[model samples]
Structure formats: C-alpha cells, structure tokens
Target: MTIPGGELFDNRDGEGRLRVGVLISGSGTNLQALIDACERHEINATVAVVVSNKHDAFGLERARKAGIPAVFVDRTAYTTISAYNHAIAEALDDHAVELVVMAGYMRLLGQEVLHAFPGRVMNLHPALLPAFPGASGIKEAFDYGAKVTGVTVHFADEHFDRGPVIAQEVVRIAEDDTVATLEAKIHAVEHGLIVEAVGLFADGRLEIDGRKVRVLPER
Candidate 1:
C-alpha cells in the first residue's frame, strides 16, 4: 500500500510487523505499554529503540531492562535545537526506525526532525488537544477548573500539540479532582490511547485528510 506522496502505507515483509522507535524524557509508562503490546502480539509493531534527551531519564533503565537498545542524545550538550534534532534524526536512522513515538518526551521537536520523519512520527499528549497543550497540560486543565480532560494521540507536526489527532479517550474531571488526581487519570488514558493508536497505524488503518484522521477497519 502507498500514499499519494509515494510514502509506503502498510508495507511489510512476510512477518507483518512495524518497527517503532520511542522517545522519552521521564518514566516510560507509555513505552512500557507498547512493549507489553508487542510482547503479547496485540499490536503488529515492535519497539526497535528508545532515545532520550536526558541522560538520567528512568525510561532508559526501563528500556535496558526490557533488553531494548537505549540511547542518550542529550540536548543540553548540543548548542542549538536544530543540532540536537539533527542528532536525534541520525540516531533514529541508525536504528532503522520505522515509526517514531514520543512518550513523555518533554522536548519540543524541531522542524528538522518533523520533516525528516514526516507522517511517521506520533505523540501522546495528556489532554484532549487544542485545549491544554505544552509541558503542564494536566495541571493547566485542573487550574482552569475544567469539568473534563483526556488524552490525545496525534501525528507530530512542527507546532506543539496542534497536529491531526488520531485517537482520543476522555476522562471526566471530578469536582474534587486536584492536579495530582487529574494527572493520574491523564496518564491512564495516555497509556491506553497511545497503544491503540499505534496499533491502528501498524495495521494500516489510519488515514490523514487535512487536519482530520480517518480510522479504517482492519482487513
């Protein structure tokens, strides 16, 4: 299968698998979710590598424990954002990464990285986006006194959480819900939605039409 731009869609060998590369900054709960799905064969994708912008990120430990190749490409060591993003793209290519997933990855990706991977990059945001975006979305939602919040899995674009949403799972914000409680709910939805969206992408069940996403039934 192929898209209009000559991009391969649903192209796989006889094994019917997709290779994934995960980027992380802190705890790798979503990465763990993907790993679990792959282990159980619940998704047709495999985590090929885990990359981190922080050297001491706990996600690195998680990846190592899972016997996956973990790399530290510290952004602080680079002089500019573009330099760091270039290095990241190189690392992903070195690992032959097919799809790039940002899970708890705190850094804002540069245009270089976005263009390098194009439609192959995905990200999990802790809020139903176009609402609360950025680093502290959960806290922002709680402070704003929103009655509902959720997680969004979207294709990564140059802008912050403004990409085309692939999937979303809503979580009700109770009247008594504090920042911590809201964050917990956000995390739960993030983990589940990310895995589900990745599964759809792996199975060639996702299509992007302008700013909208179309999910097709599995063949």
Candidate 2:
C-alpha cells in the first residue's frame, strides 16, 4: 500500500475542534458512534459532514438527524473513478474537513482525496486487518474456524484494508457462536476502537513512521 505523501496543516475550527468528514455506504452504525462521541466530548472534534455514494444510504439520514451536512455524490454521474473521488474530496474540502474517516464506505479512495488529506485519512475494519479483509471479513473469519478475531482501525492507504494499524481489540469466538453472533461481537468492538483511533488523531497523538504508528502521550 502506498502512503499518500504530503503535509497537511492543522485545520481545526475556531472552537479548537477537529473538523471531521465521514464517508459511509450503509446503515452507518459506526458513523453514529463517532457522532455520539463528538456530542459527548469524548473526542476533541466535530463531524462537519457525511458523504455517501449511495443516495438511499441510511447513513445520510443519520447525518441529517445529527444536524451534519449529508452529501450524496452520485458515482453514476462521473465516468471515471478519479472524477468520482475528486468530487468527494471537493465535498470534504468544502466542509473544511481536517480528518477523513471511512466508516462503512465501500469504495477505495483515489489519489485526488489521498493527496488532499495525506496522513489524515483513517478506516475501520471488521476483522484484524492484514488478515480477513474485504466486505465479508466477519463471515470469512467464522468460516475459517478462527478462535479469535477482532476489529482494526488504521490509516487509509491506496489498497483496501492495507495500512498502518493504529489500534485493535480482540473478540474471542465462542464455540456456540454463529456467523451472525460473531458479526455482532465484531461491530461492538468496532464502535469503540474506531472512536479511540479518531480521538488519538484529533489529539495529535498518532505518528506514522513507515508502516508503524506511534501513539504519543497526551499533553
């Protein structure tokens, strides 16, 4: 995975909160978690906007209810992936987004957005990444008879689910647990771990050194 190389200035808003743009594709349970965290002041940030490629995504409704701007950039309207991604980047930039979080977004970000945000992009995966990647991670882990699977929050790179891991929490698979149960367990962990990664980034505690990430002490 190639890291998008560029320096990004601190784009905190006047209230000293990081401005976040979250991209989602589905129900956006994770998006809700981030919104809740911001509301509760668990993180020093605010969700400025939510972007979705699918117009009917429930995440858009979630964003609307939160009073955050919800944008649907129709992929069908663009001929090339780069064009679609560029539109997404434009939307984030319009909101003064400091951090881009791919909560449940289905598409891989292109260079247009990557170059714009660089190390400021993050993603949450269902299984311990570099392991079961892709849309069906929870099912793959269950079918593989893995005893322990977990959630991973990492910096987004060019490839899918391949980037510097920021944090992970393990979920033990029980003998009685089915794929559905395992998925539930994974999502529960995801909600917390993703928020933790975002909080670390918001506080300037994450330092990416090659494939490694160092979580610095709080000031």
For lDDT, the strongest prediction is 2
Position 77, candidate 2: lDDT: 98
Query: Which candidate ranks first by TM-score, i.e. highest?
Result: 2
Full-model lDDT, candidate 2: 0.90
Residue range 60-87, candidate 1, lDDT tens digits = 9989998999999977889988998999
Pairs of colliding residues, candidate 2: none
Clashing pairs in 1: none
Show where candidate 2 strays beyond 4 Å. 1-10
TM-scores, each model vs. reference: 0.92, 0.95
lDDT string for model 2 (58-116, tens) is: 99999999999999999999999999999999999999998899998998889899899
Instruction: Name the weakest run of 10 consecutive residues (lDDT summed) in model 2.
Output: 1-10
